[model samples]
Target chain A: MAIDFKQDILAPVAADFAAMDKFINEGISSKVALVMSVSKHVVEAGGKRMRPIMCLLAAQACGENDLTQTQRLAAVIEMLHTATLVHDDVVDESNLRRGRPTANATWNNQTAVLVGDFLIARSFDLLVDLNNMTLLKEFSTGTCEIAEGEVLQLQAQHQPDTTEETYLSIIHGKTSRLFQLATEGAAILVGKPEYRQALQQYAGHFGNAFQIIDDILDYTSDAETLGKNIGDDLMEGKPTLPLISALSKTSGTDHEIIRKSIATGGLTELDDVIRIVQNSGALDYCRLRAQQETQLAIDALAILPESIARQGLYNLAMLALDRIQ
Target chain B: MAIDFKQDILAPVAADFAAMDKFINEGISSKVALVMSVSKHVVEAGGKRMRPIMCLLAAQACGENDLTQTQRLAAVIEMLHTATLVHDDVVDESNLRRGRPTANATWNNQTAVLVGDFLIARSFDLLVDLNNMTLLKEFSTGTCEIAEGEVLQLQAQHQPDTTEETYLSIIHGKTSRLFQLATEGAAILVGKPEYRQALQQYAGHFGNAFQIIDDILDYTSDAETLGKNIGDDLMEGKPTLPLISALSKTSGTDHEIIRKSIATGGLTELDDVIRIVQNSGALDYCRLRAQQETQLAIDALAILPESIARQGLYNLAMLALDRIQ
Candidate 1:
């Protein structure tokens, strides 16, 4: 069954999700015109806003009816996400994101970097206004881990020896950590400590599944798969799951080809690398792993009482798997 | 007699300043090797540790005998300073800072940007541990202004018509705001609200004077001046006070030369701009402004009772002026 993101996931918190945009606009508002314009460009360029939507859904699932504070929290989540994406575009030297010209491409790297910084500081400023000590601590610590995860991924680049454990840690930091913060933070803000662990677990596994699906798409060349550029990961020598799995399954020439591609980080052998990755059943292993993570994510929700919001959260994880399917 | 920084300023906070390094080392300690190394490189390359020293002196002047928390605060100030410098190098695209290879040059822009982010996040994580809401709010707000200031400077670049008022605004954000946070944050941490305004005023004015002197030195080449390369600002079309003042003082070819130099941002007319700026009484006006700001900074310290720490703060501002003298 095809899951409609609007009907299945975002529907539960559509009103609050829309309300979150005001706080986002307010958050990015600055006295400096350049800061405002560059920030507005990047924040608007944000894709789907999955993290904040998850936050809104998690707040609803926590049995909290008043979502005024949660809406602000969702805005902070989106701002932080936007900030990272802005820097990511600078780091990747990427010109286009979601079919829109990136901040780095449109303005310049210098403007993009400073405006990204403004968004981060502004996010923290808004987060402080919530005045919740526990929430602040969680976010502060979570941000550090998120940055470390990004650096870890950079460190792992071109290193074919990067183990699966290392890969998991990287994804956990870069992808899962923020997701954990989004849901767990809502639970924290709403004074629902009881739900913190369960929501964090659900979001963590779900984030892993989401990223794995993303990594799978980088190699999956379906003409219908909108933005997924085939062999993008291989071209960067990013030893994502497919390459990591292929490393273990192949031997001799196949292994050497994979190793050289990762180390050199180019597209000269993209076809052979993709063929070996497919032939070695690495993609199958990756799909199985994604399925397991999605199931674990869904299982984590058993602790929460049945609600439309919980079902929405479950649907988000399932929708991620649908990408792979 | 030339002021000895060690005896005149650092002498008061020497032991505490040395102890602060322990906290700095701990703050940069990350599980990720790349984050740790990049952070360590930048933090270690820090010059004179002026900001943290000012913070310790401010804490002492606030009559806080217990230096434990203050030391950690000083470390946070340094980390924040280091993070900004790392990003600044990336923005400026300069290969060297204080004659040391920048993080962007040492690793890559990607590593520098992400690790700079780690330093920022880690600084906030340490700050949240202080459990002082007032201090957190001050820092969160101050960092936003700093980023805005940086963007404002970028906006002002190649703009020959940048007014002195706009120049002050740029310097305040790029330089003084953090200085305000450092001293003001110390006061906030130590429960010295009464001293907060005075310290903030002192640091803010001191930051202005310090940056003005730096801008003056950008055009002042005595050959013995270590890192102050003449016309560096003009080369980048950075309309510092000298150029802003020159615009007010000159006419005809000299005026057009300055305007064109700023508008174009290169070294072709560098000699003409420098000759006009030096001959046009613009540097004189900038020197007067720096002196006025230094006096204001020192006067702000009058609210604090006479103490060696206060004297140290005074001397730090004085030493900044000694460069111009």
Candidate 2:
């Protein structure tokens, strides 16, 4: 059966989701005009509010009904996501994301960078208001890893020697660590210390699955379907899973072509690279890896009680996988 | 009484400063090679470690000689300062700072941006370990103001008619807020709540004086003296105090020239603008304002007890004022 985002995945936490969504606006209401406008644009432009929903769902799955702190955590999660997106646009020099113009595109890099800093600081400010040192430490350390992951990606750019292990490290830091923070932080806030490891594992595997699916889409999906042009990673010389796997699968000229394509990023060798990546079974390997991660994520959820919220989280993971299928 | 930095300012808390400096290295120690290298280069390139010194001195002035927690706070202040400088170099597109290559110049903007992020997160992570929620809230809110001040500076850039009041607000955010954080945070960390107001006032006024002197030197000091080119602010069309004061002091062509210089950023009319500013009593006005701020900063220290550390902070304020004279 097809999963609906609102009815299936977000149903158990729908009220909490709506409340958390309002907090994002309150979190971003700044005295500075440019901050308010730019933050509004980027936060409003955010797609589906996925990460915050994950935070809310995870909170409920832990059987903590008090939605007050959980809602704030959800909002903080979104603010952190928005901050990274602002900086990512500046780093990528991107004009648009998911159909809307990015913060950097709308207000230049200087404004975007500073506002991103503001969002990060404000998120911490709100987190401090929660009066939980453990949660603050978790988020602060999580953010550092997220940033390191991004730099590691930059460090690996145009380098063909990057291993799958390095790629996993990159994806985990840039992508999964925040997911871990969202779920694990909720458990921390709820005082369910026992659930911390399980939630972190669930979010970790889920984030890996999500990112792998994204990497897969970079090679397989069309612009209309993905809201991003295919070969976008290639243009940036991002040695994502497909290119990395393709290089590993091929040999001689095919290997050299893949290596060259990863090293000198552009779409000049677009057709040949795509053909080689597809014909060489690189996509198949990626799909298999993604499926394994999804299974691990689903298994991690078993540690939580069988509740509607747990089912919602499971559905969310499955829905992310459905995008590829 | 010509002030010597080591004797007059750093002497009282020199040992704590040394210990705190170690924390900076420890804090920035990451497995990511690029993060470590870029962070080390920028931290090594730091100027005087003034902020951390203020934190240590403030802790000492509060009569809390327990250097354990204070040392960590001082290091956190410096890490935060270094983080801002890294991003500031990117924002200004500056290749050099303090006669050394900037992080953006040494690495790339992407690396600098991400590493700056890592520093911010690391600083917060360390702050969380201090386990003081009040201190955490102060810093979290303080950083938000800092970022806003930066954005306000960007928003006011290239636009003339920026009022002196607006310029003061800008300086307060960009310069004074962090200074306030450095000293005020020390008091909070040391459990001297009453001294928070006094230390905050001293640091705030001192920061204003410091920034005013720095801005004055932007027009008056040469690359040889200040390691920065004269008219650097004008090149960016920054409506700093000298420009703001010059506009108020002039009329007719002289006024129009200052306005045009600010409106259209460049050095075409740099000499004329500088001549008009110096000859129009703008420099004297700025110098007078700097002196007044320095006096105010010193007066704020009366609430604190007579201590060697307080004397050092007082001497540091005076030395900053001496830069203009």
lDDT of each: 0.91, 0.92
Which residue pairs overlap in candidate 1's backbone? none
TM-score of each: 0.98, 0.99
Worst 10 residues of 1 chain A by lDDT: A221-230
DockQ of each: 0.91, 0.88
Q: Which RMSD does model 2 reach against the true structure?
A: 0.8
**Interface Cα root-mean-square deviation for all models:** 0.6, 0.6
Query: Which residue segments of model 1 deviate by more than 4 Å?
Result: A222-224, B222-224
lDDT of 2 by residue, B152-226 (tens): 899999878899888988999989999999999999988999999999999999999999999999998999889
Worst 10 residues of 2 chain A by lDDT: A14-23
lDDT of 1 at A57: 92
